[model samples]
Every structure is written in C-alpha cells, then in structure tokens.
Target: MKVIAINGSPRKDWNTATMLRHALQGSADRGAFTELIHLYELDYRGCSSCFACKTLGSPSYGRCAQQDDLAPVLRRIEEAGALILGSPIYFGQVTGEMRSFLERLLFPYLRYSREKRSLFPRKMDTAWIYTMNCPEAAIKDAGYDRVFAENERLLKMIFGGSCFTLTSHETLQFADYGKVDADMFDPAGRKARHEQVFPRDCERAYELGARLAQNISRGLPS
Candidate 1:
C-alpha cells in the first residue's frame, strides 16, 4: 500500500518537513510505500468555488474542477492508503499555502443535499502536524488550538477517517537569535528546549506512522 506525506512548509528542510519525514520513515519501516510532497513547490490555488463538482451530470462531479498543479496531487491522495500533512503555524493559523491546499482538498467532498456525504475515499487514514512558535503550555492562551481542532474535525466528520495530530512547540525561527529582534522569547532557552525535546517528538512521529500504517492495513481506526 502507498502512503503520501505532504509538507506545507515553504522551507523544505525545516521543522515541519523534518517531522513529516520522520513519520514517512516510520511508515516506510512498516513496509508501506511512501512518498513526500512539498506543497510550496507547486503552483496552485484553493478551490475556486466553481460548483462544478456538485453539479449533476458534470464529468468532474465530486472532484476539484480547477486543473492545476494540485489536480494530480489530489489523484495521488485518492489512491493512497494513508496521508500525513504538516504545516507551520502562521499568525495562529495555517500558512496561506496550507490553507489553500486544504480548501481544495476538503471542499470537493462537501455537498448541499441532506445525505451529508462527500466524494473522499471511505477508508483513508490521516494525520496533521502543526509546528508553532508558541510554547505547548501557552497554546490555549494563544487560541491556536481552535484552528487545528477544526481541521481535525473536517478529516473525521467529512472523510469518516481516524485522525492523529502532532504539535512541535516553540520552534526555533533563526540560525542566530541575535540577528532578529525576538525579544519576547529566550532564544537560548528555546534552543535548549528544542534540542532536548525535538528528538523525542520525532520518535512520537515515527510511532504515529507505524501505528497508522498498521491500522490502515487492517481497515481499523488508528
């Protein structure tokens, strides 16, 4: 079975991408064919709200109508057994790229009828990773939890799939703290914490990957 991990970070090798790679490695170790996609590399827009996907007799019914870089990616997702998406928090929300990607990814499944069903595959297992500058203890205060939680809800309610989440908190923002005026954060302290905790976070991501693969293979909740 194939598993696809999409990185929503513009920096391909930064924290978000690194965590996704670890998760993919875990899936790979469990014998699932894995591929990684960097969303920023593609030229695409969010759903155009064309309504063609919802129109009767439309050839592209229940699918995104925009023919762009994301169309093929959507096809890949439709065929995959599992999916993992990672993005860094931008101003308490997902980056514009990630938000656009999600709009296209999930909007096609929405319908106006009473049936409340979507076109998404019935059995795909999914996970979301959010990296943030806010400390873990301060997430609620920052109110970023609502954004990611709503995203998780979309995966579960629309897709009827098991959803997992990971957050890397207080992420380092620069190679040298002195170069930027990050006065609110203790750069040295944040760096030290990241050094101590990131490895463990990666381990958790690996576990998530392995567990997702196993559960998806068995057609069970992860």
Candidate 2:
C-alpha cells in the first residue's frame, strides 16, 4: 500500500513538516510506500473555477483544466491508500497556501468520492497534521471554532474518508521545541513546557499514523 503526505508548511524542517515526516516514517515502518509533497516549492494557484474540467469530453473530470504542478499530484492521491496533510496554523486557521492546495487537491477527489458509488466496502483515510505558535487555549479562542469545524467538515466531504487531526500549539522557537520534538507537540519558545509536551504530541501522532495505516490494510478507516 502507498500513502501520500502533503506538507503545507513554508519552512522546510519546521513543525508542520516534521509532524508529517514522522507520520510518514511510521507508515513506512509498517511497509506503506510513502511520498511527501512540499507545496511551497511548487508553482501552482488555488483553482480556476473555469468549467473546463466539467466539460463533457474533457479528459480530466473534476480536476482543473489548467495544468500546472498539481495535476499529477492529484493522480497520486487517487491511488494512495491514505494521505496526511500538514499545515502551519495562520491567524486562526490553515495557511492560505494550504487551504488553496486543499481546494485544488480535493476537487477531483470530490468527484471520485461522490460519483463513484461502489465505495461501500473500503475507502481511504486522511489525517491533518499541524503546528502553531498558539496554545490549546488559543485554539479554544472565541473566534476559531467555526473555522476549524468548517475545515473538518470539508475534509470529510471531500476525501470520502475519515479524519484524524494532530496539532501542537505554541511552536515559535525551533530549538525549544526540538528538545522534546522527538515525541511531542511542545511549542517552540516555551522551553520548560517543550520538554514536557513535545514527546506526548509525537507519540500521539505516531500512534495515529499506525492506526490509520492498519485501517487501510484491513479495509477500514479512522
């Protein structure tokens, strides 16, 4: 089985990327062929609402007709057993780049998931991995629930799969987080807290990955 991970972080080795990589690494250990795509390095735009993809004779069904770097990526997503989408929190939600990418990425998947009705026996599973400079309290902020909830619903509707979210809040300092980064979601700048929280986050993520992979192997989804 194969899994594709999309890294929506602008930085190379930062929290979002690290979490995705580790999740894929755990999947690899379980013999899942894995691939990682860093969207920042690609030249692509959100999506053209052009109805070209919906044309009767168009070769691509729900995917955009404007071909760039993301077209091929869509095919990979279709064949993969699972996907881990990692993004850094921006303001109070996923980054624009990641959000746009998700829009484009899900377009074709949405067509397949909704139109192809034989998905009763098995389906793909996807997880969201994220890191932020804010704390859990920040996620609980008054204004953020709607945004998070909307994204969660969109994920489930688009992927025809279950969703698992792993998040680490308050990740501003790389060094501080690295201390416990091997296993947890400790924020970067909070040195003392980093040592305590990072490992747990990592462990949780690793376990999530394992469970998701096993689900695919057993024709189940988490």
Candidate 3:
C-alpha cells in the first residue's frame, strides 16, 4: 500500500508537518510506501473554473487541466492507497494553500449528475490532520468543527472511502514567544502543552496511519 501525506503549512518543522511526519512514519512501519509533499514549495493555482473537467467528451473530462506543480501530485494521488492532509488552522479555516489544493483535487472528480456524485476511479482511505493554536474547548464555539465535518463529508463523497480526522490543539506556534508581539497567548502554557500533550497527539496520528495501512493490507475498507 502507498500512503501519501500533504503538508499545507509553510513551516516544514512545525506542528502540522510534525503530525504528518509521524503519520507517514506509522504507515511506513506497517510496510507501506509513504511520501510527503509540502505545498508551500510548489507553484500552482487553484481550480480555474474552466469547466474542462466537467465538459462532456473533452480530453480533460474528470481531470484537472491546469499544468502546474500540483497537477502531477493530483495524478499521483490517483494511484495512492491512502491520502493524509495536514494543515494548520488559519482564521478558522485551513491555510490558503490547503484550500486551493482541495479545490483542484476534489473539483474534477465531482459529478454534477443526480445519480452519481463522484467520478473518482477507485476507493481509498483519506484523512485530515489539523493543528491549531486555539484550545480544544474553543473549537465548537468557533465553528471549526463544522468546517472539519464539511471537509470530511466532501472527501468521503468524492473518494468513496472511509475518512477520519485528527486535531492537535494548543500547538506551540513559536520557539520563543518573547520574540514576537503575540501577547494574547500564554507562552508558559503553550510550552507546557508542547512538552506534555503534543507527543500524545503525535502518537494518535501514528495510530491513525497504522490503522489505515493495516486495513489496506487486510483488504478492509478504511
């Protein structure tokens, strides 16, 4: 099985990327080939809304036509047994890069017909990992749960596979809070959580990846 992880954060060694790396490591330990792609390194635009993907009889039908760095990544996803997306919550939503990536990745396979909702070629496991600076209690109040649910729903609809999510809250955002002008956060608390809780979250991410790989190996739906 092949598991691919996409990091949507600009900071490669930060919370979001760390969670994805742990997940990929778990997948690898389960005898699955794993790859991680960082979106910030790529130059690409979101879906152009040209409708070439939706146009009947067109050569690009059911596929994104944009020729860019993300296009090849989309093609590779077609052959992956599982996909894991990691992003830091920014302004109550995923990072802009992640949003754009989703636009290109999911739009093409979306069927407009009433009978069929997706044109994806096969079923595969999909997951989302979100790292946020906010506390866990604030998620529902901030309506972030709704965002997570909607994304999960869309992935399940388009991929025809099981979808799950992992969220790491109260992530440490800076090495030294005193260096930045962010007085709203409690540096001591953040550091405490980083030392006490982040490892638990990383362990959960690893378990998630292992479960996906084990399911794929056993011919079970993820």
Q: Answer with 1 or 3, whichever has the higher TM-score.
A: 3
* lDDT tens digits, residue span 1-222, model 2: 987889888887877777777788778877788898999988889877776655667776555676888878876787889888888878777888898887677654454334663222246788888787767886666466576667767777766688877888766556644555455553434665556676677777777777777888887755
Better of 1 and 2 by lDDT: 1
Ranking by TM-score: 3, 1, 2
How many backbone clashes are present in model 2?
A: 11
TM-score of each: 0.96, 0.83, 0.98
* Model 1 C-alpha lDDT per residue in residues 90-188, reported as the tens digit of each score: 888888998999889888887776786666757677999888888889988888778878888888866677888999988877878998987988988
User: Candidate 3's residue-wise lDDT over 101-192, tens digit each?
Assistant: 99999999999889889999888889999999878999899999999999999999999999999999999999999999999999999999
Count of clashes, each model: 0, 11, 0
Q: Poorest 10 consecutive residues of model 3 by lDDT?
A: 213-222
Instruction: Please name the candidate that would achieve the greatest lDDT relative to the true structure.
Output: 3
Candidate 1 residues lying further than 4 Å off, grouped into runs, are none
Total colliding residue pairs, candidate 1: 0
